[model samples]
Target: MEKITLYYFLVNNKATLGLGENIKLLLEDAALEHEYVRLELDEAWNNKKVQLVKEGLYSGTLPYIEVGGKKFGRTVPIMRYISVKLGNKYHGANDEENQILDSAADIIGDWFESAKLAFNGSNEDKKKYVEVDTPRFLDIFERYLSAQEGPYILGEKISYSDFLIYHRLDDDMALDRLADYPNLTKFVQSFVERPNIKKHLASLSK
Candidate 1:
């Protein structure tokens, strides 16, 4: 099999902590060979890596990916594509469950995009993003989780959606009361104990 290459356009820890972390975890869990090359905006602009940026700028933003000499933008699509290729036991075992998992994955992608802007924006914009946007986003997700059964968004087996949601909630420190939603809390807790993810969590401090 030809090696798959992936370059994650990231800045600091925050960038890696969210979607970047999700993709990395997914890839590792699938035992898929990959690489992460951080894209430094300043260095790229100054050093004329803009062309490379442009090529990866399918959606004109970071978290973009280059795979097999082709650029793929948008997070969920990439995640799905990789999951299908790797034959990972994510997205669950059936069609209905897979759809639900995919929908939750979309929610996670939307929330992460909102967060990226919120964190990168000016103080005023940040306030609006935090106060207005986040609550709305979280409310939608909370309901989504409420509709599900225990220990996962879809219950029982973990899915791609779980990885995305768990990473966002845990990394952002946005969910205040996990106890309020016991199932979601337990789901996240279960993942937190996974070997690959646990190792990455520890590496966050270094």
Candidate 2:
């Protein structure tokens, strides 16, 4: 088996933070020996990113990740595939667990997309989006957490789901909604402080 490689293309910013950080952290937590190659976006990548998006090499989205020369367009899918391949067991041990994890990841992805609109759109539009859409998303995640006992979404074991939730909250915090979910806030605090995560964030900041 050839050593799998990951090429991560991203802008150094918050919009891509959730997926970007989740994938980066997941790789570290899993302790997979893979190279991290970034194609820092500039005017140059605009054409290429667009081309890749059309080719299904990327979603033309930030935090573009390719593994083994094949691109996985979205963050959660990328994380899920890597977790399964590395046998990290963050997704779940059984089929039921995997389903639950997948559902949780989907919820996070939805919230992230909605919140992106809130962050980037006009003030009036942001207000309307948050008022009309944000709470419902938050409510669903709160309910999901209510069913789990954790420092993690999968209950007591930190899986890719926790990483997704953690980074989403952090990325979404700027939009003023993340503080509403106490369980998520506490859960994120617990894992984000882990040495590897702290190190990763620190390195990125520098």
> Per-residue alpha-carbon lDDT of model 2 for 1-206, expressed as tens digits?
13445555554543244456677788777666666666666787788777887778635775556555666766777777777676656768788888888888888777877887777889997887757776776677677776777767676777888787766656655234657777656666778687777777677667
Residue 100 lDDT, candidate 2, scale 0-100: 88
Report lDDT per candidate: 0.68, 0.70
RMSD of each: 3.4, 3.5
Candidate 2 lDDT at 24 equals 75
Q: Clash pairs of candidate 2?
A: none
Per-model TM-score on C-alpha atoms: 0.76, 0.76
Clashes of each: 0, 0
The worst-scoring run of ten residues by lDDT in candidate 2 lies at 10-19
lDDT of 1 by residue, 39-58 (tens): 55575554444565556564
Show model 1 residue runs off by greater than 4 Å.
13-15, 43-61, 64-71, 120-125, 128-132, 175-177
